[model samples]
Target: MAMKRNGKSPVSSDTDEKFMFFKDVSLGPHETQLRFRLIHFWEARNPVKKTIIGLEMLLIDEQGTVIQGFIPPGRIKKYLPDLKQGSVYRLNNFYGSKNKPMYRVADHIATVSFTWNSELSVLHEIPTCFDEDRFRFHSYEDFEANCDIKGDLYDVVGHMKLVNGHTLIERPTPDEVKIDTTRHIMVHVQSHDGPVMKLYLWDQAAADFCKKFNSYDNTPTLLLVTAVNTKRLGGTLALTSMSPSRIISTGSAQTRRLLIKQVSADVVTKPWYYIGCSGCHAKATKGATSLVCTNTKCEKINTAGVPQYRAKISVYDNSDQAVFVLLGDAGRVLTGRHASELVSSYFEANGSEGADHLVPVPEALISTIGQTHKFCVKVTQHNFSGDTRAITVTKILSLDTPSPTEASVGNDIAAMSEGATQSGDAVCEPHKGGGVTADEESKRACSSADPETAKRPRCEN
Candidate 1:
């Protein structure tokens, strides 16, 4: 039988064999030929048993109709070798089965299932063309309408506003423990002229996003995610990734900048610094003779502990106020001195009691109480935990000129001068005479067991 080159013409031969369109297929066993392009495919698994169910696929026909396809495990080897994405194929003998009601990827009513006698062959030298791909996008309002329903899965395209609360332009160093534990990337994405929404890319989708995001010289602004499940988290609309989700990012880079006032250092509630493992910079556990790294991926066994700044300060703008946690070099950026310099200077002046000695909040941090600065904050999952109001500040931006590496996403804030001194609920006054003991300081600072909670310089573990 000779196949027709033009898609409009009926594909028939002398024996009256004809090609079937996906829209015309009905629920039943069929011995007909179906021609389509394998858009994408993945292994479907039993969620509970963690066993392979079958090879699931999204196939598109010449008429631009898309439908779900499946290859049973028993016959996978027969067609797996020849199965290639984006290649047109002729599938003979398939059972038309009812489509799943939930998490439906395509709009079809039935699925094309490969049977034992199915003959799958690539259709080469096709003069006619097929649609490259298709997407079903919903606006912020549309997503909110379907939130928590677990209905049909859809695609989303938007410009990433904030990645884990940090500007997308800044590539923060990856934390092994944080990545292993969280295992997700929460991005605030905004569609064209739409409200910003949170999208959680989990597991492989997160990994794929990271890989594609870093592959470019400049950060990509436009993000296209396929097969996302909409959810309502903490009374907020959230979109999460599924097993077959694909991430595609491209466009000019953009940065998310926030302008706020540094009200006062939150010295009474939390510590200003933490003794971190020198190797990985994670909170260290105190050993009998040495400090050990809490990060299991750290190569060092008994790594020396280094004091790192983790100062929490109350910050506010004209409208809202919240606590901001200064991690790593952000303290140095805000203050002219480093945590090590302040700690060493304090110890040098006052005799060393022990490693657990609490260091007072340096005057450098206190001096900036009423200052205003543009900050590039790194928002983490901890911010959404509802336990604390702390937002992680990754970098302190200069008001002069924006960095060449960063581009403005929206309206830029005007430069503001130093504001009047504002008193906060948790203010840190200078420690006079002798520093407080570890037990006294711990009692005052310890609010929650969360590691991100500010406390004095000690081995966290």
Candidate 2:
């Protein structure tokens, strides 16, 4: 006979079967009953094969002990229809199997696997309370200790210092195109007074972060990520999101700006711009009849090509010196002229040229030398890999106020004057007649003929 608890039918106390806690579960078939709350569940898939391995879950008992649970692909249909995130459930028969060591989300020695005859039912009346959720947060030092170990995955909470090198409050433009094909975002976060650590969010985690970040009127500074894997990149500890990872943001926005003074342009070594796919803004290759995007993930097979700025310049500040690559919108923010407009103006006046036509460094970019300005830069895997010494600048900040690019659309003249502070140097627009002056044409002709410059790999987006 079942007993009533708080006006609801409770598990029958008169039953001969005894209920066991998660801690008591051992490796073998368990005929006894186990009660737990389903904290969360996600599909586990084989990365290489792209096949579903099983449905993985986190379960918590009345004792607040959390354990990993799994339902084989064959039995998923039996239990998935009734599975709810926070619902309390009872399992009659389950197999106790050893938990996999790699990418373990919960600190459990064994996993509860559903058997062919296993029965899952909702608990109408819970006898005891179960914790709603559980989290294991690790400090920077703790993560550093276990870096690249593939041990127990943990959670992290901190104040976001940078998102793709932009401040926490900075938002991307509606039409902004990202060159990174992976769509991953890198964030610098610091917990308390600890050192700053890099967190890379990929795929769904990146989408969730952007959704939560933009939902608020003011940007959220505090960040919390669950089940993150730690890896050492360039000998520095970095945290990365896993398939089961979750992102949470709260608290007020914090701004930390990075400013630098333009020392010189490196146009002698690298071209100032690249032809990119109009669809995805990735570098485009010359196709049989048309240009094609180099990004394998791009949907467009044949796409129109457009010239985009990718200027490399040496920059210095009171602290140190570094090379920064001004790409796409960042170049427009500094020069007040789009790369397409400049390329078109040059070609229209000089006549159509070959694919290797080297557009001279625009006077607009050269005019910014010795000027100090704040910049938004992205730190990519290339930076960690030491493949490139230049950091990609995403946006340029004004000296007096935030650029209209960050606020709303405004007058181009006003935005350029405020956004890019010129050192009393005259800003020269692209020459509409013959593309270049005698002096500038001489410089371009010499650079174009140089075997070394021609041998240097073209700058990729």
Candidate 3:
């Protein structure tokens, strides 16, 4: 009573017909049925037409071979809503073709496109052995070898040693019609005791990463990035996230163990610098009469610059020694004293209105110098002005030496968590008011205080 599309009857899950693996899929006119788990998927919009083009999916069969799946716009109302990521499904009546190398998100050599005659049904009794493939991870050498070939994706896992806040850039999309102007985070990822690679997270992926990173009470020092496109920018190779990319906040078990081992080992640190710009928390330069923010785009002037405490420390393990910079909030966490309070104390110790009117390094912060602490330092290098070498600290984990003033810890904990509570939800701007540009919004975002000296508390709610 039914027509056999491929010179054979449609096979059901209950039947004994051999299961079709993803690798078996080819550019054939015959109907082939398959059951696969949807690993990841995303909706695409026609940039020129401004209409939906159904969705793109990455699926894996029991054999662990990956294949690209597509649903055309005509079938959107029927299949798009029913399809869920990470679910297994039985499908048939799709056509395969050699994938477009220029737009390949997955490494699959073949792609399947759904047609009007395609059929899909949810599969409840999936084989227990069916699991997502552990991707083939590459190293710096592999990156160097393949970076020139564009549109190829790869996997990387590393310790998030350095995390820069955010930078806005305008990028052209695949169509070259619409430009995506968004914020990107520059993260330095290092493999197991190996070389470091630059990773750039743009738009939503960047927001998600920042949220999980700062919001959690105990953030992860390691991360796993899958489906990263290799790009050579400014004479250096970098990893970038595509639409189907996945960023694991809590890195794999192996990486977590490595990070723990690295942190717990005999790591010693000494305080280096004591003051910085209150807004971005960059090292403040000694101006003619006041401190100037090293960040050139700073909205506030040097004289009006709100003074915040920064700590630079020399870190030494058996292997090597490095200098780390800790901004206001992280410094406060380590010393159990707010930067503003320390600055106020400095003003009190020395007469408030000196020729420079600069706040001296507070005793509370100075005591930390030459002392040892266990810090979760993100290792990144910045040479915007010149090729200066130093290790940058992204976050502070713990202090080996107990706080001298134990009572201050209880008082400081509340103030320290105030900013973190909102970090997961908001963008980098902690105290953001309506602003004109992305750069301006970041500048106007609330920190501890206004640049004006009259402002009492350094940070605003």
Candidate 4:
């Protein structure tokens, strides 16, 4: 028992003594990494009379260096710890620099994130495991039935115009303006199991088109997609993300139940987007199409042209049981702002709509992109010696509907920017006495030129 002096208890005001560890601590140094945990601390009054702080330390990998440090008042004890006295920890990091030592942390005990020298490459020596009772999948064919994914799907054989040669860069006369491309012909595919898959295509027109942009050597590229701003072309589409769709892939017998965790990170996703045109309209249906026209009817067939369309793929490992890392960009498509703008302009210019089809290309494509959901995916990374490394992917999965945009008849992506300006509950903007016309504003809106009665999807392509 301590005696009271001058109205206060005679306890020591030493924070270090009171914060002494009470349980055993452990620290393991792997590669250059040091993983440790603080069990507990206590303050004991020794027989000699003065206060002594007792810290139970385990100091893992006794030979490896352990980080010894101190904590100040209002900084040491703040919340519950994830680790207990006998708890174990495994951190894939390095022994930090003493010169640039770590700072004193308040709620560091319960923090889920840890700092490292740089982006560390995690070694996956063992295969991930899963219950195999969850997840689902849909091939390019099913994507076809639901989406406008074109190609000789059932033939098991098709071609993807990698690069187009006959791109009309020169200002077209009334002649050049008429012949241009605007539709995308996606070669449907089948979903299979494995650690790796190949998605390459071949096309004559695309290959010849690619040759024009080649250096003096006349060497053509198998996947050299360049973006150029043209009056009539399409924008590019990257696989911003790849989560397992409705279903997940598991071991042969357990395909029904989605293995959410393992496959989650295996998919791919990108934050920003780079647009580019895919292709041009074929012969036959040109003059009949009209969306934002002056006297209304302005349609004519343009020549054949296919713009550069990028590729994005996501792989999955249904063996693991977590999905936090699955939503991310798969670097499958090209990443140049020039390429992005080129693609965006294509969809903006050549793309038009008929009362039947309703939507136009390039610009219409942006609207389509806006309507689609955003997702994430992970890939298999290969780690080498501390000096170097490499990585490759094998499977792919599209996870659940993680994030989808809200769309309504009056409120669409085209109007999203305008919607934010008006009062939250305010009435719609009234056209200045007259309805919307071509010269009034740039590009066009979903409600542009008055809603011309709902109609069927015109078979323009």
Candidate 5:
């Protein structure tokens, strides 16, 4: 007789919940309150059930809290395969590492989620080690042997040992800062073919990885390098060819360029190379353009005589769906796709619903961008002839968010936002395939490229 209370319907807004269940949550020691950006999270049941039943969310945070996000209770027991994939799934439970807290429906075993509770987070990330000739990874030494070692540097994969009990491994969130300045790093790798065999860090975040691996080297606790998808900055792109005395060339500045060579244990990066800009962010290409870093909005153009343009993106509406505002399409000439396609794909890989939930062409999808910073984007410059003037992504360390970005913006806008929450409705930003008005563009890109969500059924028409 009553699905109404205080004039509100039983089901409030999609995110709206009964005030009773909206209990305040707090942070604990050894457990900092973090903003987890859900990636791809899914669950399935036993013999009785057929398809994967639950949602697979990719949740990451800049506060070093990178892993799967909270799984609101009732979700474990009430999942339907046919349910929209991008639909927001939330739950309140103790997030942990390893077996215990995978999924607890009634304070009982969930049986469908990953075996992670407190001690070990799931295998959310893999190290970036691969060959330059092709996108294949050097997960094993054999993989690298096949690649023609053009220079003194060689690509090889093996177990990496971390020494300390609690070492600080860099969290490789897409929006993490790239070491903009060039520096020297120590490394140790076995070189048999004239010191040509180089060591590759599996992922960019693994840059500071130092752990205690049981002598064998296969320990899951041990950092596994060389077998990641090898697609982004952190993905084996920082390959440093080495010599017994000096280090050779560092990798490329282009986004999606995989790392080819690397140092294994304790080799150091040479003096000539710069760390590029912070991850997810971009810098100028040599002899092409030079610019200073700025927020996604109000980005400044420092490069002169070149077609230097910048894009400004913001999270809008009560939902705060992430959106980008590009200044020109010339940048697309370098990336081969239009500004909308490139920008859309960037968010698709980094957004909440990922590429699948991308809005229709010429329509930007309303969703989170990379990690916690919704406005993060990859920027490049081009000549008037449509040739690549330079390619650089512009983003900052997500760890600096909330404190730097939010603290400066103030309460009015922040208070009304979903507060790092994702929505299912597709908010379309009006965009033109060949060039349309900013108002005509939708809020998000199509989800055609999200790695995990491509074939997965999501909330798309």
Candidate 6:
């Protein structure tokens, strides 16, 4: 019943001239024109970094309802100029279909698509309600309350306090034909209010964050991260990025000045123990009388009752206190002994203890308590315990000159490092050559010198 200034209806006498609301777009052929303002626009890309087939658009209507639209790559160029983000447009002759629920961009059950013959016209008037941009941000209290809720995702922005080095993980596909190795990075951050949290990044996100921080300049202290997923582990709430997440900076000159002043303010204290596997240098766990390799891929065991170093120490600076575990290189720097040597010395001194019995803590390990050292730490939730948090040492820094007794230990460490380098092997940060190329059955036949072979004990059945 609506008519333009002219005598006839806008489209036709029989057709409706009133713009269709986003909520009204359903799964059917339609002659109705939809007028909406663009909220977001992006090009979809594949995992291999190829430009995919569709242009994604998030549109909002006057009623405040949001809808998603897709344009095929072939028809994208025709409507490129009018597709400017935040612009208002009236589109007609498009088809609406049910969207894939698994990767739905919006809450709507249906998505609109533009056909080759679709008509689009720019509108100058923008809706006032839809003009203000808003983000669904969660406070530290909200994260604590709903961290265990299924499928709950949040948005958070934090100032970067520390960035840890990269670590690689190899995951086997369902078919098990090849393993995909992914690089992961962790960043420690805090909000202006009071809460501190950790952000984990993978693949391109990890690489990008590291590249920015490691560059000679342009190290941003503040990062605004969106689309975060929460998880409860080892009694702490951990935040990770969802597939659609992004990081932006909100740093200022004042933050940079503060960062320089606090660089050496003695924030996190040193760790006491560095329990590592003699084989892959991954952290090991006590299993009854034996020390089991935590790396699922490594087959090493310590059934010989060799004393396993267990570093679980509480450290506190004036600002904060945290319990951190040192493993691999960080452990080595503190104890000044290789994990294998620690095991050997323990069994040598405790020859009276049966190989199948639980071994006591070695004397060398007990001496490291209360000693101070610089370390790069990452916040992680333990896999088995949801309510407990584990601070993992990623790297170590020597703050002062070594004593004569420490100098002797450093020589031994240097000799071991040299030998490990020649064999393309590393105890801590096992990326050098730790993983086995062969299958599980063939791996058992490998020699003792093989890094993977050390995961198992000689007395094991």
The prediction achieving the highest TM-score against the true structure is 1
Task: Give the whole-model CA lDDT for all candidates, comma-separated.
Answer: 0.66, 0.66, 0.56, 0.23, 0.26, 0.52
Sliding window of 10 residues with minimal summed lDDT for model 6: 438-447
Could you tell me every candidate's TM-score relative to the true structure?
0.52, 0.51, 0.49, 0.14, 0.19, 0.40
Per-residue lDDT tens digits for candidate 4, residues 1-461, read 33222222222223311111112122321132223343222222243765443221222222232233222223223212333442333343222222211111121122222233212222233122212111113333332342222211111111111222221122111111212242221211113211111222223222222233232132221121111111111221111101101111112123212322323333323212212112211111224442222212223223222222222222222121111111011222212223335444645664663323211113222222111123222112212222112111111123452333233423543544442322101112322333322211211111131111212111100
Candidates ranked by lDDT: 2, 1, 3, 6, 5, 4
Candidate 1 vs candidate 4, TM-score winner:
1
Q: What global local distance difference test value does model 6 have? A: 0.52
- RMSD from true fold, candidate 5: 26.6
After superposition, which runs of candidate 2 have C-alpha atoms over 4 Å from their true positions?
Answer: 1-17, 169-181, 249-461
After superposing candidate 6 on the true structure, give the runs of residues whose Cα lies further than 4 Å from its correct spot.
1-17, 48-51, 127-129, 138-154, 164-186, 190-197, 200-222, 228-244, 248-461
Q: What is the lDDT of residue 65 in candidate 5?
A: 26
Deviation from native of the Cα of residue 368 in model 4, angstroms: 20
lDDT of 4: 0.23
Worst 10 residues of 5 by lDDT: 452-461
lDDT for each residue of candidate 2 in 167-197, tens digit (9 for 90 to 100): 5444442111342355688887765424567
Q: Is 5 or 6 the stronger prediction by lDDT?
A: 6
- The better candidate by TM-score, 1 or 6, is 1
**What are the RMSD figures for all models against the true structure?**
21.6, 22.3, 20.6, 26.3, 26.6, 19.2
Any runs in candidate 3 off by more than 4 Å, and if so which? Answer: 1-14, 45-54, 165-182, 252-461
What 10-residue stretch in candidate 3 is worst by lDDT?
170-179
Where model 5 places Cα greater than 4 Å from the true spot, the runs are 1-34, 45-56, 69-97, 100-255, 258-461
Candidate 2 structure lDDT = 0.66
Order of quality (TM-score): 1, 2, 3, 6, 5, 4
> Per-residue lDDT tens digits of candidate 5, residues 258-358?
22133222222211011112221222233435544321321334522122123333322222122233323322322334444444465666677552232
lDDT, candidate 1, 273-365, per-residue tens? 887767656566789898886555457899887787777666644334456667566787889787888999999888856756787778887
